[model samples]
Target chain A: MSAKIRLYVEHPLGAGQSVPLDRDQAHYLFGVMRQTVGAQLLLFNGEDGEWRAEVAEASKRSGVLICQEQTRPLVLPPDLWLLFAPIKKVRTDFIVEKAAEMGAARILPVQTEFTNSDRIRQDRLQAHAVEAAEQCGGTYVPEVADLQKLSRLLDHWPEERQLMFCDEAEVGSALALASETAAQAPWAIVIGPEGGFSEAERKRLHALPQSHVVSLGPRILRADTAAVAALTVWQQRYGDWG
Target chain B: MSAKIRLYVEHPLGAGQSVPLDRDQAHYLFGVMRQTVGAQLLLFNGEDGEWRAEVAEASKRSGVLICQEQTRPLVLPPDLWLLFAPIKKVRTDFIVEKAAEMGAARILPVQTEFTNSDRIRQDRLQAHAVEAAEQCGGTYVPEVADLQKLSRLLDHWPEERQLMFCDEAEVGSALALASETAAQAPWAIVIGPEGGFSEAERKRLHALPQSHVVSLGPRILRADTAAVAALTVWQQRYGDWG
Candidate 1:
């Protein structure tokens, strides 16, 4: 609700130091938003946390913000992870934003056999995650992992973490699986692509010791819907439901 | 999957009698799907349920299909209702489609003070609901109710049906309020608009004997996300979680 706050995860913030924002950020803050000298702003580094600052100087091409004081402390994120196969561009961005806002500790893009988009712009997706965190007032940002093959992901899967596979073919409901799996250590949600996971992939997932296949419902949901639906179900079952 | 089966809700099927498909349904079956006289199709009514049929005659403007045999019996929908404030066109359509797929028995559009789009085309929304029902292989189409003001809706509220208000301001975790209230009778999920409910409306909702203001999470979700999230939580708690 205050003046537009743009967060950059660059170097640390200190008192009476002018840090130049990136070109795009500068354009957004200065050109689009029309912020001038002495205007109040907010900044945050993942380590140092949030800070209130003031624009010390303004220019057509660049701008500088001088850090004033720390507003909040850096907080560690939960160990929840979100693994989803890429869909269309807009929906992918929406997933990234919603995942960040929903407090996923990590976001992993899996390349299944039915995945439509293999050529994902990692940096752009990362930016959207950052924006989502900033917008939702989250101090911790989730790390976006590079795209990996589904088989390769399972190959190097961590034994300690539990993977909740949102299997559409599962006969029973998701709530039972979610409640049972919520008591486990660390958890991640696995969402399939538009055409859904191949039968072989589903078999392999079912074979994994750490994997638990759960159904969202009787209806056939799109990949994007599945992502959000699975996340909501998981959060309600585990995470911070209290 | 089999020849793009076009489903329609019409009269009961008999062995030899040919039923004339509506003009709109005919256009979709013949012109849009490019089905011919011998094409296989499906038809269903709320009473006798789904059936297999074959196109007896195909025309550019209209067509007729002869019923072959019954496939599945009529399945009753769950006693669940989705009450949400209508948002933008695409998002409203999305909510209608998802609600139908998710097996809502009824969809009610509520008009709050903060609701923006008052000119909701009920027929268009109903069509979307029908399409979703057909696509999801549902025999019963959820009834889309006419738009009613929030006050007016509450005035005539059914005393037995419990209302789950997805309250964003709730501090604690989201859980089914009390089994006594949830288990008493039918249930409905109340989702606010983008701007959320007014303070007075929130107060009135809290005062209702059948209302439970439950939180979704710590993070604030968009209205559309809130709808899906609330429904998932409800289904997990009181609906068919088994």
Candidate 2:
């Protein structure tokens, strides 16, 4: 079996402190994993770090864990964000999983004119982010925000955070832009919908001071492929690839 | 509309030559696309290059196209192969699509000890590859080889072709390996099955002289994710990342 690491959003975990897990966590720990009292498991809080805990009481619907000691300290993630248009259900899930695995600090779904999916379950997407983080052994979970209009996102864009826009219309290479903008700046990758950014949206993005329109390659990639490809380019250019 | 390109395995294509398309091609061009006589299209042969063609005759089950002029020369693809253990049906199709989009010269499905799906429909996978190539506007199509055992593949391993084995067991950085080996030789990325490589299989791979065990990152990635990540790393290092 894989390692039994559980994440809780509750208070400080101390030695011999009993903490009752929420219904969902308890179901996963006791019902799904079939853990009884005295079973050992790892726990992590977004703030205080990861800790080893043991089951103090187990029930069919709920379980209690007593925190023992710290396993690892909380470390901040890289200042990188992933902003993408939500595609089909499965592809959307894939984007979130890969973004979390690739160490994105935050994930935001944008609604563009050409975006197909209108009903995005933010809670479900957030759960996927959490599961991905848990599977990747990351103590810090990237925050998943609700779906917002692309225009609104642009209006509230942070001036300091550079936006590396994966533009299909660009004729030249992406490496030059990636290398030029990758030098110690808070960066985010913006992937358009399958139909791509609308003409008006592209024009506005081109006008942004911090936006760099980069081409992935000569071919036109699907939105999901573009997301991963753009992320790979970013990681190589400005991320912790060194 | 996107470029209408038709692929044929026939003789050399020359300017001002009327060619009869077979029943299947006719069904696709005339029945599905609903193109009548005098419609313009593109045709490509592996040897003679790409050509613009016009419909000379149209029937219910057969059609004729006359080549007008050459659009582009037949450029040979890079000598890179993708060897992967087949997974579920959808995922296998996904692998083929991505492989085509990423410019793999050939794709080989190998049977590993822990491979979940033993039976693979070669025809369906080939169709997916063809669709991906057509959509990506690639003149060259990646040949999908029939399933073979991993041991058999290793037995007839080409010494000149280096294998970049994406070893999930390795925990350090992956950038160095990508850079160091990018220029060494023609390479292939070998992705393990869902359960990963067995101990004996890992040992054999490690023992291969031309094999380089490289890590992706500090996270546990799914097999598909690993494949894409490894390819991205390779592309950034040695591919036409222009």
Candidate 3:
């Protein structure tokens, strides 16, 4: 019933390598989590596989951990990205956390005409991604990009990456998504804000050759729920879900 | 773009039928939502199809509406049940809310050996289910059953209903779930708690003749996220989603 706490580190992880903890990490392990010297926990740098680390020193504000052994190999998530328009503060955080846990390699926040939030706290969101990875036993932490306008993002969109446009107005089921060629091409799922995509934005997305408008189901889902549902369908169809 | 406000009512909806609203509903429509007499909105009673209703009377503590026409037919969710061990209050509410929005016909909270929460507020959860349906534009609100011990529920388990047991120990993709018979039969998706099922519980589930062990994906998901993933896979395979 007890699982070792997993921490995300920015330093390299290797045997005999001593990793320094920042003030917050030290506070988390020592003050909040109540860990002491010699305590063992897993650490991942999103580069190295997860490593078992021993608490060499535990202080209130600073500490160090020495790597003992590699517990798990670094397993990268699929080359998939989740592009969504930010909604309420809590819901936006929910989307990022779920996307990280559900195996999205990257997350993009898009600014559409109906988008409510003007800006996003990128650092905060990236930290949430890291926390989600740590909690879900994921070795890789997906990067959360700065918010970008939909038009600008579309202009520089990667042509080869298939875009699974979750259009609320779409009529058919998403079963056809599984029939798409299961190639090694990268993919992205775009979810609109609570107000949905503007007409112009929808037209532009539909015109893109790489974009495939797919429906989630018979009912309309909130933005955060749509993120999970779309990611699930995408992973089941082509991503390494199986 | 303004979507009509949708309300859940208990009265039958028909042409010229006056629907009485309670104190909270009246305050919601008049005070918070700023709707006046003659304001049009949608209403559903779970038994009847969604209907367009016009406010015939409006007050801070009470209101009345006249049904105009049926907007949507009563479309029942697939005969799917979501059995899960409740976790934290907010996450448990999230699971029920999402289950209702995602088209689970019924929700059952199970208590396993490893289940952390000692008790669950069934009425509160049911209210959350109704709120979710009201917000998501769902006509059919899934019933949130009171918490029951997993063992007891398993003993009286319906043999006709196939249980898609989401075993965290199971390896491989959920695509295998799609291969199960696509006949129109009852189905249930079982999700354990954060601690997961005990070895004995897992053994019992595996031994059940109607249980099919399936993995959600490559990564291990938390209880709430796992619920969404399992439901998505089930709907895509046998439910009304795809």
The TM-scores that each candidate's chain B achieves against the reference are 0.92, 0.90, 0.95
Please tell me how candidate 2 rates in CAPRI terms.
Answer: medium
Tell me the lDDT of model 3 at A62: 94
Candidate 1: deviation at residue A107, Å? 2.3
User: What are the TM-scores, per candidate, against the unseen true structure?
Assistant: 0.89, 0.85, 0.97
Q: Which 10 residues in a row give candidate 2 chain B its minimum summed lDDT?
A: B1-10
| Top DockQ model | 3
Judge candidate 1 at residue A62 and give its lDDT: 75
Model number with the top lDDT: 3
The better-scoring model by TM-score among 1 and 2 is 1
True contacts kept of 2: 0.46
lDDT of 3 by residue, A90-196 (tens): 88999999999999999999899998788999999999999999998899999999999989999999878888899988855574543345346888999988888
lDDT of 1 at B175: 65
- Evaluated at residue A172, the lDDT of candidate 2 is 50
Per-residue accuracy of model 1 over B105-164 as CA lDDT, tens digit each:
899998999998777899999988888877777777888999989899899999889988
The better-scoring model by DockQ among 1 and 3 is 3
Docking class of 1: medium
Q: What lDDT score goes with residue B242 in model 2?
A: 55
Model 1 lDDT per residue over A10-93, tens place: 767877666787778777887888888888877877677778889877877777888888877775556889999998887888
